[model samples]
Every structure is written in C-alpha cells, then in structure tokens.
Target chain A: MSTRLPTFGNVGLAETLQNRRLLAGIVVFVVLALYPAMTLNAYHTRLLTWIMCFAIAAMGFNIVLGYTGLLSFGHAAFFGTGMYTVVLVMGRVGITDLVAVMVIAMVVSGLVGAIIGVLTVKTHEIYFALLTLALAQLLYILAVRDIGGLTRGTDGIGVTRPDFFGIPISELPAQIYLLGFYYHVVLVALAATIVLLWFVLRSPFGLTLKMIRENETRAEMTGVPVLRYRVYSMILSAMVVGLGGALYAVLIGHITPEYLDWTMSGEIVFMALLGGIGTFFGPVVGAGGFILLQELALSYTEYWHFTMGLVLFIVVLTLRENGIWGGAKTLVERLNDRRGEQ
Target chain B: MSSEPILKTENVRKDFGSIVAVDGVSVEFYDDEIVGIIGPNGAGKTTFTNLISGALPLTDGTIIFDGEDISGLQKYKRVRRGLVRSFQIPQIYDEMTVFENMQASVLSRKQENNRLFTPTHRDSASVSETERLLELFNLEAHADDHTEHLPHGVRKVLDVAMSFALEPEIMILDEPTSGVGSREKNAVMETITEAAVEQQIGLIFIEHDMELIRDYSDRIVALHEGRVLADDDVAAVMNSEEVNQFILEGGV
Candidate 1:
C-alpha cells in the first residue's frame, strides 16, 4: 500500500513484528517470571516489590502524559489518596478486605479527580501541569493537617500484610512466600492496565484525546467535548493512579502524606517523560529503567533523584524521543527510510 | 418540517462585563440551507457563533436544536445533537495524516456516552463512507499526507472535510475560506456545498468576502455594532444603504 505517509516497513516487517504488543508484557513477565530465582534472598526480593509499586504508578501517569498530552503534577494526590483510603478502610472500618479497600480507593480517587477536573480540566498547556501540582499539594496538606487522626498526619500509618481475598497474606513470608504473590499481583495489575489503556488509545475516545492534545480548538469545532473528555480522562487516569496507591499501601504495609507530595508526583512525570510520552509503551520503559536505576544507585548514593534529574534533562534537551520501546520501532523505520531512499 | 427546527436562537444576548457583545440577536437556520453571517472584526459575529455552538456561555437566551432546548448544554453535547462549528483557520493534528483526521471526525459520530474504552472499530462499516468523502473532496491523494506538510490550501480543505465527516444536522463554519488564496476558494466551496446539500445539513458560515456571501449563502445576516442591521436575501442585504455605509465607514 503506497499510502501518502510511509509507515513501519510495509506488511512484511509488520507481520514479523506482529508480536510487538508483547514488548511491554514480556518485560513484566520476565522480571516477575524470574522472581523464584532469588528464593533465598529476602532483601533483594523485598526491593523488587517496591519496583512493582512504582511501575503501577508510572503506568497510570503514562495514560495522561504519554497518551493525552496532559502533564499532571498532582498525580501523587490520587496515589496517596488511595494509600490513605486503604489504611482507613483497613484500620477504622474493620474491613481487612483487600478487594474492598482497592474499590474504595479507586472510587475516592475518581471523586478527587472529578473535583480537580472541575477546577482545572479546561486549563491546558503549562497551566494544566501547574494546577495539577497545586491540587496535589492540597492533598498533602489535607493528609498532614485535615485528617490527622485517621492518616496519622506526618507520622504516616503502619500495618501488616493484607488479608487479600482471604489469601492469608500474613502467613506468607515477606521474602520467600509473598514474593510470588506480589509478583503475580503486580504483573496482573500492570498487564490489565496495559490492555485497558491500549483499548482506550485505539478507541474513538482515545482518538479524541489525541486530537484534543494536538489541537484543542479543532477538537471543539468537531463537536468533541474538549473539556469534558479532558476531565473524564484525567479522572479515569487519576483513579488508576489511586489504584496504584492502594496497591502500594498493601505492598509496603504503610501509607503516608509523603505519597501525596508533589515530589512523588514529579518522579512519575519524569518516568513518563524519560521513557517518552505519546507512545504506548514509553512510560513503561521509563518506569522500568527508573526503578532499576534506583535499585542499583541506592547501593552507592542516597541522592538518586539528582542523578535521575540529570539524566532526564539530558534526554529532554538532546534525545529525539521516539519513546523507550518506541525507540526500537524508530530504528526499524529509519532503516526502512534508508531503503526507500535507495 | 415535522415541527423540528434545525436550529433556533431566541433572544441570545452575551456581555463582556459592561460591554454587550451580542444583544438579543435572534435567528433561525433550516435543513439544507446555507446562511452566512458577515460583519467587521468585533462585530459580535464570532461571539454569536460561539454562543450557538456552546463554546461560550450566553448572558441570556435559549437555543433550541431539533426541538430540544440546548442552551445550557456543553459544546460537545451540542455537537452530539448534530450542531457543529469550525474555526476561521484549519486546526489539525500536526502529527497525524489527513486521512486520520477525517476518520477522527467520522468516528465521533458514533461515540456512545463519550467513554474512551469502547472500540470504535465496531462502526468501521462507515470507513468506506468516510473514504468516499475524502475522494469527493479531491483529498484521496493526500490522505496520508502529514498535516504539517499539507499546503495551506489543502489544510483548509482538510479542515472543512473533517468537519463534514461529523455530518452534523447543522454546521457553523467560521470563515470557511479565510486564508486560502482565491485559486482554492472554489474547490473548498464546491466540497462544502456538496455535503450541505446531499446530507440536508444546515450550514452557517461567516466570511469577510462579501462576494462569496453574495454567491454561496442563501441568506446573509449583517451585524453592525453587535446588532443585526440586515438579515435578508443576499441581494437586499448587499444593496441596503446602511450595509454599504457600514462597510465603507464603520458601524452605524
């Protein structure tokens, strides 16, 4: 097909890479799939659990930043809100139910998103990022001051392993037993997010988001609800971020106002951007790379954010981002371009 | 005819603080008809269009579309009911291709509840119809052309084509042929007219070129100082002494 714009390597190459959807899936699979290899190392296994938490959070951030072209600085609000919700649901409500806690966190986050959207959905460009960040700070303040009793304010909350679906999580050792459980749980959540988001990007609504990102006014003239869709996507995305927070609280046995901090939100934005934005698998790459870097760097220095910030700035200024996984596709495209030129 | 007004604006008034931009300007649009609103800059032509398209909140008045009062509804909701508007210049996704642009609009016509999860391919049967629009607009060759690379004329045409893909009951084109050279003006008008006539869609266009208003629009609404100085057949509106004076000097 001699279409006006050249695509990736015609049908022959596209057919061969038909398995490319596994690009993100296989990475998660390999990491989690091999957790049993370190059955004896408790510390290493525990570290991997934290990796999964940030990965889920990064996945959520990628939805709006990478796909919708909205850079949200208040994502940690939803993330931490979910964590707080989980703690309150578990401790105060006498509900040790993981499913119930997750559901509640998602609902709370969704409501928070709706409220934030009402204030800021219509604002885009640099204004959008600033507003989201402000909203995130609001969450942090509320956690520290407004709900001190329930949230434990600055001290945060401590809890034990969750009783997930009556799965007896406490009986499972932090290192040996629950590693498999966490590996599975995280992989499942990540995979489900990828599939769900992929569906969204391919759907009409996703197309509209991309359109709104590219040209808000044109999208409006087309009869697409520019503000509503933006708000809707933001809310849905924030809800997912909240789910990440809930999952994090369960995985770490803790919830804190720190989770609501803009710094935490900024880190996810870096993950979304470092891997690349507007590409399906870009933020996943950033999430994976960031987690790995943090894991490796912690052994040497406590100030890993400085190192990451340097890397991020370099990438932003110099790198012609095709995104992380998108980089591979770019290579193939460049090669195809050379061939076409010849 | 069946008692459903294609579009109706009753006592639509909008104010910017102390400045009244649109002062109770009432109008109606019908199926298969093209109406043009012409006025100088800041004549409230754009503001009036924005009000009807749900882009701006009116200070007062109700807008009825197909017998439904859509005065307070959102812009996208108005579009969902087949009331759409286009901007003066073509606004497009620079990263995507021309065909993708048309498809984007075509798919919106079938979006359910505006959720982003459902597959749009369920309605891919309409792809051929969209393709037919591309070909009719002489855009088939440039279907894959990135919007950034499109000539200004083609971009404007693509913008109009994308608007048509929505197949709205009434399309408000804000300066459809604004920037393009005279060479491509006829081509743009040809496509716009074809869609408006075939789909029985009502078209309201704003043009600075009185000649085009004289030629294409079934009727012309002339605004002077945010009030309709003339709303009549193109001949009468153009020949009115007040209109000639307003154009030659300034608002009445």
Candidate 2:
C-alpha cells in the first residue's frame, strides 16, 4: 500500500545466519553426547539420561503447545500409556523384543491420543487445556484405582529390560549398566527423535501448524484444514511422547500410577517453559534445567515443591515471554546488532 | 473476455432471528472485472460477501461458481475452488516472515501442505510464486521481515499478496484500504486494481470511500437494507438518486 515503505533486507544474510544457528545447534548436540563421558559419574549419567526422556516428551508436547497453539495439560496420559503398553505387551502378549514392545506402545498411545484429540479439538484455548487435563486425569484414575488387575493399581508395575534382536539386555554384564550403556541407548533414541522432529518442523505440515497458531481464521480461509491437521498433530505428538515413555520404562525398570498423573503433565509443561516454547531443542535445555533445579532443591530440603515453585516464579517474572534458549537467542542477536553497527 | 459468469448468487438470503441481513440478493460476476460494493452502515455489504465466500451459511438460496452449486461448501473448500477473501483487518501471520506468510497460502493452494518430510522452504515453486506476488505488491523489501515488525500499510499489501499467491479466480476484499493511510489509499487501490487486471481475476471489494469506489471499479453494486438498490456501471450507480440520497449523502 505504501510505496514509501523502507526496503527491509531479504534472505541473503538471513539464510547464512540461519545456517550458523543450525551449526550451533549441532555443536550443542555433540556436547550433550560427550557429556556422560566427561562427567564420568553414574549418577550424573543416569540423571542426564532421564533428562533426555523428559526432553523427548517435551519436544512432542511442543507440536501441540508451541506450534499449534494448543496448551495441553494431559500429555502424561500419552507418556504413561506408552510405558504401560510396553509392560502389558511384554507381560500378556509375551513380547520379548524391545522394538516390538515400543512399536506396540506407540500404536496404542496413538489410538488413545486420537480418541482424546477428537473429543478435544472442537474446543479451544483454556477450554481445550482443561478438557485435556480432565481426560488425562480420567486415564490416571483408571491406572491407579479402576484397572487394578491390568495396571497393578496404585502400586504400579515393575519393568524388565527386554532383548534387543535376540540379545538379552537384562542378562548383559553388570559392568555395562555401570558403564552407562542404557544411558547411551536413551541418548541415541533422543538424537534420532530430535532429527525426525526437526525434519517435521521444517515440513509444510509444520508450517501449516504454525500458521494455525498465528491466525486460525486466516489459515482456514487459505484452504488449510484446521481440524484435520490438528488431529494429525495430536496423534503424531502422542506417538513421539509414547516412544519417549517406552524408553523411559526401559531406563527406570518401573512404571507407577503417578506417571499418568496431571502433575506429570504440569512437569512437561514446565520443561517446555524452561526451554524456549517454539524454538528447536529448547525443550531439551528446559528439561535438563528443570531436572537439575529439582535435584538441587531436593538435596537441600524436603520443600522441593516450594523451591521449584520459587524458581518458576523467578523465571516467569524475569524472562516473562521467553524461556532460557529464547533469552540466550536475544542476547546473541543484540551482540550481533552491535557488531554490525561497529 | 468470453462474458461467461465466473460467480453468481441467486435469491441468496440470510436471516438473523427476526431481522433479514441479506434479502434474496442475486448478482453475477465475470472474470477480469473489478466490482465495487458500497453501502451505508447496516446495509449488508459485508454479510452478502460473507455468504459468497462461504464464511457464513445462506438461510435460503443457491451460489453457483464455475457452473457448480457451492452453497453448501465449507470456507476452506470454497478457497480450494479459487474463491478467496481477504479480511478487512488484514489477517496476516504476525510471527511469520512475509515470505512464510505468502508461502503458507501458496502451499495450501497447491495441496502440498500435508508433506511432513519435505521442508516448506524447499518448495521452490511456492517460494518463487510468493516472491513474484510480493514484488508485484511492492513488498519484496519486507519479505524476510516478520509481519508484526512491518508497517500497517505494508502488512495490508502483504495480506493481498498472500491472497494472490493462492491463485484465486475471484477475490473478495472486505476493505482494500480501510486501515491504510489517507495518503497511500490511492496506491493500495491502484496496486490491487492493476494486479487484478493483469491476472484477469474477478475482484469484488467493499468500501465506504466514494472516490475510491468511483475511480477503480468498472461497475458498482449499491445495497440498502440487505437488498440491492443499484447495480450498474460506476457512473450510473454514482448518479442513481436512491444511492445518492441514502449512501453518498448519508441520509438513512
């Protein structure tokens, strides 16, 4: 409309800058890979491994929460469902292969996710969030009290490491566990899932999800099927979280009723907030930060909840609109701007 | 031009409780024509356009587009059939760059938005088409800038460019220059008119500004109380006694 509009620079330098940012991301991943070796402590290795599992769940949650603009407080339903599926299949179906168990878990979780998504997609914003939370709590109740025979009720079920293509992991030398072999397996899954998600985020489907996030009406008018895509997103997100959960079951060797609780969903949300909401790999950073803070707080006192609450309050107050990665990104951008001026 | 009608509504009516918003209004539009819809407040200019664009359902009537009845089509289905509409408030993605904004439309129109493995930026065709529209709308400069960071006028132009990227046969703009600066109103209308003529796409726009309506539209459809008061060439509509007294003179 205004020809006098200032001509902003195009993608020439911006593309190069994006590539640099990607390179920085890869460097971070490399460092994360080398972390267990550097720390050389089993506790730290196990802690980091658990952090990876949480990060994976957070990453999956980001599809709905960050990209699609849906705040889901029920992702733990999918996470716990995935782990429970693994345990059930191994116990009832006599599935001994870890991959087969994970595959089944992912499928079962996806079906559950689709059912929940169908019921919830019609509502939006706070209502959608509330519905997801309610449905998740329904699953939690089923796991904890209603389905005691199948789920072991409030006590939960113990998980045994299954064979990997005929190789019995549970019978593996005890030294390997001490050497963090399971930790490396978790890391590999985390890395592979991250790469897959990165591709998805770069895809046209991802762009459409972001468009829905930015403006739902505009997206609908532009020929984007808002409801259908959202359902797909929910299923995909659930699958990713389910996979993470399956891996988590393998890592922890146990599944508890609390795994499906609403608090677990809140923890996932906190992890996303700890990292940048929409930024790639922000959830991973957030999970690590969240876990470290929780561990640190628990070490000092039993009031870890209060300590965690205080830390979250500080973050929300100081950071306001962004998580840790977003804050760091802003700082870097500011530095770059000053450098350009010079 | 073949003179074949690109879009038509027959006895299209919409009622809200006891009040009839669009009372059996029928109009025919052809390709390569710019039709301006002007009316006083509560005249149903927007309501009629909403029905045509599938934003709202018709209480009773039939909408024929390209010789097919599309009265029951959903908004997105209407868009897929090349009947697109731009919002009066310019609904562009605030967080996305201008390039991404246009690319979303381009991708959706191509039915390539479901590809989960291929990166959106890798669609060179959509990218090139988006760039062409941006250049046509004089928005190439802000293609990489986020829509929120751009000026309101630039964002308006980007909104139109994104619609154009959908390759619509007919575009209904609620207000082409409603929020545009007074000085740049001519630029906005001129750019839109020139692009519509160049692409030979049918255009219908709602406006309250008399001068802009008179200057850019080949024909004008004036509405009053949810009914067509005048439908003729711009000069004829401008000279109509009813239109003059009701709309132009602000005499309800």
Candidate 3:
C-alpha cells in the first residue's frame, strides 16, 4: 500500500490561483480595467474592450460548466438573448439605462431558459448537449425570420446606449469608459457569483449536484432530487449567459443573429474547457487567453481558426494524459515540498 | 423501546414500467437496532434503500420519519433530517482529504444557513467535531491526504466516516464490505462495528456474507425475489428451512 498522503482539507481559492485558473482571470480583468490607463491608443483600448466583452460572456459559461458541470453548447443564445432584450427595452421604452437593461436581461434570459430548460433538463449526457444546441438554433431562426421587425431579422438591430441618468454616453471617452464600467460591474457580479457558487457547491444542494454528476443512482438512493437540481443549474446557467449577452451588446455597439449562433455557444464551452475547469476561474483565464490568442493569430492570418484548433487539440490531449490541472499542481507542490524540506 | 420510531416505510412500492422492484413493503425501523437487509440480487435491496432515502418516487406508500412524512422530500432535505447513506462502491470525494470531506458533511447538514449569502462557519464546534471523527476513524495521520489517493480500505472507511459527520439518526450502509480485499475486510468490519457501537445510530446494512451478517446484525430480514422470506434473530433467520433450502439450491 502507498504511504498515506497529507490532507489539504477543502481547497478552492488557493487551488484557484496557484493552479493559475483564476490567475489568468485576474490578469485578464486587471488588464481590461487598466486599458485606458495602460494604453493611449483608442483602437487598442477598443480591442481590449472587446476582449473584456468575450471574457464576461465566457465567465457566465464558466458558471454553468465550472460550477454546475453542465456543458451548454448554446450559451451564445443566452448571450444574444440578453443583448436583444436590452436593445428592445432601450428601443421600445426609450430606456437606455445599462443597469436596468442588465437586470431585465437576467429576468428575460431566465424566463427564456426556463421555457427551454423545462423541455431539456431530464435528458443527460449527449442528449442534453444536442437538445440545447437545437434550442439555441430554434431561437436563432425565430430571431432572424419571425421577429424580424423587433429583432431586425438576420440583418440584426442597431443596439443603442441611451443616456446614463441623462448623461449622453456616446459623446465622451470617460462616458464611454463609464459605459465600459459595466464590464467591471459585471466583473464584480461575476466574482460575487463565483463566491456564491463556491458556497452553493459546498451546500447540501450543491453536493447533490456533484453527487448526481458523479453517481446518479447512488445519489438518488441517497434521496437527491436530481431533476430539480438539474433544472436549477440550467436556469442559473441561462441567467449568467444572458447577463453576459447584455453586457456584451453594450461593448460591441450592436446586437446580431451571429451572437445567437452555434459558433458563439461553442466558443463559450471552448473557453471554459481551455481555462481548466478544475477551478472556478479556469474559464475566465481561458476566455482571456483564447481571445488574446485569437487577436494575435488574426493579426497574422485568416487561418487562425485552424491554428487555434490544433492548439486546443494538443492541450486537450496533453491534459487528458496528465489530468486536468493535476500535472501543474503536482509540479508546484513538489517544488513547495522541496523548498519546505530545505 | 423508545416512544419514537426513527424510520418507517409504509407499503412503499416502486415499479419501472411493469416490473415492481419493491412491492408494498412495510417496515418500522427503530432506534439502536442494526438491521441487516439480506436479499438475493433483484430482491429490491437498493430500490428499497432509495425509496426510504427519497431517491425514487413511491408508487403508493408513505415514508414517515419521526412522525414526518418524508415520502417525497428532496434528497438533500432527507439528508438534513438525518437520513444518510453510504454507497456500496464508496463515494468518497477524491479531490478532498478525509478531514475536508467530513467538514463538507458538517457544512452540508445545515445546508439552508450555509446557502444564504455567507457561510455559517461561526460554529467553531464543527471544526472540533471533525477532529473527533478523525480520531474515531483513525485517520488522523493522513488527515490532509486527498481521499482519492487513499488505499481502497481507507477510502471505504473514510466514506463511512463522512456519513457520520452529519450525526444522522439513521444510516443505510450499502454493502460496506463489497469489493474490499478479503485481507482488509476483517479490519474494515471491526471499524464499522466499532463506529456503530459508539454512535448508537440505527443502521440498515446490506451484506452478502452470511458469517459477517450473523456476527454483527441484531436481527436479519431476509428477502428472496423482492419479498420478505424471514425476519428474526440472526441465527434463527440463518437456520430457517427456507434459507437452508435456498442455499442448498445455490440461491444464497
């Protein structure tokens, strides 16, 4: 038998950063927050803002995949759902309030999610994956053809940033920065969401979720309401992705059917997986890193997708052989132990 | 002997399509008694455990726990009310240590307060209780070890230790010795027996080994083909003509 190992008790935060899952997230958010302070060029600042946009959306996807273990391939639909909800609110009621838009997006996305999730939560594994994808596509088709006037069809709608408390938002950089401030606010919300997720997973309900994920029959035998938790996790999933969509619309200056596309949904999953789902901040880092990688590669050539795909394939293969974040953590611990021994 | 029965299953029947897994079974589980549910495969042992634990919807029966109908309560809700179960395959959280896994259980016990805004880590007593269970389980030395890395025997025992963390009134241990090495089974059973004696919690255990069941259980309830064949003292149930014939026919 192997020698008994030292127990670290419950590990979440130290594991989050030292594992560099949240490390990448911290770097992404900090850089985005400091962009105006760091870079003088307006173009670079906007690019960074776009990076922050995707980062926020990816963070929402992280909440579902990272915390709940539900792989949603149609989060972009939620993103688009949020974005369009905000635009309609802004356009219809002449309401251009960002905070109000964000809240409305959450409620709208949650309701939209409930409508779809009720139909899909009972199915597990690949069926869950396929059902979400189809639903996202169904919404996308509806947004494009059926609700063209409200949604502006496949042509998309011109997303507007109304007066923030009667302050003309578009006329000034600081005002734009205040507009960009929504990302930071969303970041704070995301961070709070992460902490709340930490609490939830540690709670009995969260344990039931993990229990169901690990061993459904065993968990059921233990009296876990599997379908209920499944619905809750998915609804929570929709809320996060929807909030990201609303925040993203402001960042991009427009809302489109592309935001609701499968590619958009697939991107969120990719970011979550790439960042190291072993910890909460893994996707945050992955989203930022992937967006930065996209920026760097796009500047060089049109085949960036192919290049990124290869990179993803390689990392996944390597991660599989070594275990997710397991290798990196062991290496760090070995170093720490050697230092301690010294 | 007490006024309150710890667990009662009232005609709880479950069917998957046309097949009845547990059929109209009524049982009143009392305090301080070790119940051994001895059933052949497909005898609905697991199904019955699930029904009582709120894992499955009952076809027509109510489960009353300490006068509360927990018939269709959520799994976590039942766990909060002190109905904890350990799996046959030992579901220990591999990433956490023995101490952390137990701590999670301690926290999980009060899941309601734990879920609101901030964690109720104000109860310093839980920390020490964790330490006590560590000593009780003899897992003090490797309290920091990620449970996944523990040996099969230690992991299985750690799972039992986790179930005890919530201080449940009743526990269902499903095949606590299955897949455990023959050499390790004796020591594991000793720890299980000791833990049970120390806790004085009602236990419903499923075991295939007649020798082990005979040695530990206060009473044995035998099942064959989803029906109770006998419920009596260990020796009497073991020595029943039906049991003897079943064993002779290689059904044991």
Which one wins on lDDT?
Answer: 2
Task: Estimate the TM-score of every prediction.
Answer: 0.86, 0.93, 0.83
In candidate 3, position A52 carries an lDDT of: 53
Worst 10 residues of 1 chain B by lDDT: B118-127
Ranking by lDDT: 2, 1, 3
By TM-score: ranked, best first: 2, 1, 3
Write the residue-wise lDDT of candidate 3 on A1-342 in tens digits: 112222346766766678664687688557756766555566666655555556566666665565556677778778889888988898887677777778888889988877777888777668888888999998888887846568878777787655556667546665456435544555566666666666665555554555555545544434345566677767776887787778778767777788888998888877767767665556656777688888889999899999788777876777742333444666799999999999
Candidates, DockQ: 0.43, 0.49, 0.21
lDDT of 2 by residue, A37-109 (tens): 7877777878888888888898999889889989999999999999999888998889979778888988998
Error of 3 at B12 (Å): 5.6
Query: Each candidate's iRMS in angstroms?
Result: 5.6, 6.6, 6.9
* TM-score-best of 1 and 3: 1
Supply the DockQ value of model 3: 0.21
Q: How close is candidate 2 to the true structure, as a TM-score?
A: 0.93
Model 2 clashing residue pairs (backbone): none
Query: How should the candidates be ordered by DockQ, best one leading?
Result: 2, 1, 3
